[model samples]
Target: MKRILIILVLVLICTQIKAQRPMDWAFKLNLKDYNVKYSLPKGFSHLDSMISSYCRSDWSELFQYSLINTEGDIAIRFLMIPITPKTAEQLEYRKRLFNLSELFPPNQNYLRTIYFQLEADTTNRIAYYPKAYAKKTFNVDVAGEYDRECKIVYKGKFYKSKVVFLHKEDRMDCFIHYFYEEGKEEKVRETIAKTRGMFRLR
Candidate 1:
């Protein structure tokens, strides 16, 4: 009986180890009175704010935290910015699809804020793989749900990206991941999920 119990314990331990297959590193960011926490896959680390400029562009300027994969040049950048008026108008127009007010006054800002992030990030990433120019594919998900993917090919390798947009009462949260090498889609998804899981209002 004691031998059986010992064997059971060993099995449980092995299972636990297998379940946590991908290791992760965590970090937090404070921006405009909001606290954001997220994790990177084991080989990535947060880059200093001063050196984070490389990830920014005129359209996507509000950077929260930037991370680089230690094993390679892969990177993930987080951004948050206020919604613009034009964006609000588009959202208000879309709301009409559900018989909501074409004026959707209250949600116009909300929708535009999220839309701008999606648009800016998607465009900026395209420039990085200009040579390959593969097909650009993405989906406009429901306000609270996410399921978007973008692909870029650099040199002879393929890079996969997942961009997420979240609209808060005050601002929009944007998350982007670039798997610099080919075949890291699962890892990229896992890292993005871990980061989103740590998001907090305060």
Candidate 2:
């Protein structure tokens, strides 16, 4: 009887410990336009506070949130831009700038160099959400998705990174960028999918 009682107490203690552990993901930030929640992979940390300070110094208008892992190999950024007619026109113009063929005219060398510097791949395309979700959540016809493996020069070191872009245009435009170490591309993609799956728009 004493042995059984001890076993039950151990089981109860284990269950309580597990319940008290933090979730893999949680609500992280609240902004004027929307709220954001995020999760980092096993060895990562959220860097919103540090990144926010740098963003406010220069990109305060568009910067929303940012995250980075402890190893400094992965990062994510969220930006929200209000959609006015003028801004919509500018967005369209910037989209065209991604066309390599159209980039052959004025300052071709500079433009092409900048393009290759980012190593933008040819995978840009329209990303469609579920009809119900599009209508209800973002009210957008479609989102723009692009991903690539690129090289980033940071602090005098070159890092090969996989970058993913998710842009949604509605009453406001939402952009998300996910950057991870190149060799972990598949894992990063899975993480992004899971994050989006649980993403909240309030």
Candidate 3:
């Protein structure tokens, strides 16, 4: 009877170990060259995969993965582009051009308004770990928008959107586009902060 009780206790311990396993992520990617892995945030669910198939645009080629909250009010769209030597050179040239443009107020304003529709409160060059080459978070005023699936859910209501860009030289160039309503900036900021922990490199 003592031996039988020991086996029962061992089985119970094994069952508890399995129950404590980590939560499964909805999306995961392994970049062999970089020796890094990427996973979607823990709380978010995978956005519909079909959305990527139908969306065709210049940036569409870069689309990789996406996630959305249960309420559907908040979403994250990820884009990744491989860095090439020629592209790196072009990026440097663009930086120089931007610097030159900043010397002229009219040119700077024009570029900002036309490209970003940026709002008054913009934060730039905030660093996050595991340390990307550059990181920028900013707000933009945009017209009514649809979700990745092109559904008319958010139509007719203007949106204040947040955009985050993270560039890791020779490894990854990624954009995380965040969509949320007006008063949820604080929540979104917290989510952005969590991204630092989500990505890691060997």
Identify the leading candidate in terms of TM-score: 3
Name the better of 2 and 3 by lDDT.
3
The deviation in Å at residue 64 for candidate 1 is 4.1
User: Could you give candidate 3's per-residue lDDT for residues 165-194 as a string of tens digits?
Assistant: 544544544455566765787877777667
Candidate 2 pairs with clashing backbones:
35-202
Candidate numbers sorted by lDDT from highest down = 3, 1, 2
Q: Which one is best on lDDT?
A: 3
* lDDT score at residue 146, model 1, on the 0-100 scale: 35
**Span of ten consecutive residues with least summed lDDT in model 1:** 132-141
The per-candidate count of clashes, in order, stands at 1, 1, 0
The lDDT per prediction is 0.46, 0.45, 0.47
What ranges in model 3 sit over 4 Å off?
1-30, 53-62, 86-159
Q: Please state every model's RMSD to the true fold in angstroms.
A: 15.1, 12.1, 12.6
- By lDDT, the better pick of 1 and 3 is 3
Report the lDDT tens digits of candidate 1 across residue range 1-202: 9999999999999986654332212223234334433334566775543333422243434444556767654666555544445656656667877576534344344344444435535433322222122111111112243333333232234244455544444344344545455667676666655555334333
